[model samples]
Target: MITTHAAIEDNIKRYKRGELIVPSDFRGKGTENAIKKTLSRLAADGTIKRLGHGLYVLPKKDPLFGEILPSTEEIAIALAKKEKVKIKPAGAFALHKLGLTLQVPTKLVYLTDGNGRIIKVGKNTIRFKSTTPKKMALKGELSGLIILALEELGTDQIDESTKLKLSNLLEKENPIILKQDLKLASAAVHDFILKLILNK
Candidate 1:
């Protein structure tokens, strides 16, 4: 039988490296229950945080701000991979990527076609939205991100400068693969992207 303290130490070491582990990770040699108990104790001690269900992460500390660290989207991606689900940044994440917004979003939104759930890490929330993989793949990063930004910005937000920047970036990135689908996009999305490309 693995000792509770030893298991807790080992778990903390693994979590420090950005690994998310559950009781199953300790499944061998009849250590599952002991490991779960140890994990709960550690969580109560603030050595790690519970991210919902059986998910947990080692909290990172920010030196400059003297506070707990911000949520790492990479961790979210890794979690999705562990759950065998495909995910892409959406909403505020997409907005930030488009250079249209500078706010640090507290909620990490991901587009996925799989089951959706809300995960709480420390004081922040990470939300997964169930969306078709095609929609997730569409907008194709830069263009998609720009589209999301425009959606948040509304119709009048598609100014000449925003169009020029978006066009240049799209031309450089070349999201032509998304064009056919873009034709069927919302009127604002289709018109804005097409006009930017044509005008240039």
Candidate 2:
């Protein structure tokens, strides 16, 4: 007979390996109350952190600090994956990486192909916005970051220095897949950057 604590331990191990397990995963073989109780006990012991009502994750360790680093995206991805929803990091996350925005956004947003929701992980909020999967995927990781930056910075904000730096970085990274698409979408900024690069 598998005890509730034993089951919880097994689930925890699975979660550490990047598997998302829900209460039903264990309840299918045991009493729902037993599984819930065990989960609660594990959460209280810090073996798992409860993201929201039913979402949970095994805390990831920070190698440098030897402590758990709180990240809303990681939890959100785990939850979305378990729920069979497709999600891609977007908005501020992409913008910050693109150097178009200097501010670190408090909320981690993602474009998804399912219902949107706000998930609370610790004190951080993860937001999901429903969008076509093609659009979500087309915004390659770096392109998405650039788009976010451009959105925040606006077209006129692409000054000479910033344009040169961005162009150089993009060239180095060879983000050709998104170059034409992003340029077409951001005509003003694209022309400005092109002129600056030519003049330099």
lDDT per residue (tens digit) for residues 1-200 in model 2: 87877966875685553344568667565688888788777878988766666665666666686546445666677778777888766655665556656876778787778899987666677888786644555544554555545543575645666667666655544457656446544566556545544665
Model 1 spans > 4 angstroms off: 1-16, 21-37, 45-55, 59-70, 148-161, 178-188
Which candidate wins on lDDT?
1
Pairs clashing in candidate 1? 139-144
lDDT of each: 0.68, 0.64
Q: Using TM-score, give the best candidate's number.
A: 1
- The per-prediction CA RMSD against the true structure, in angstroms, equals 4.2, 4.4
Return the clash pairs for model 2, or none: 94-145, 95-149
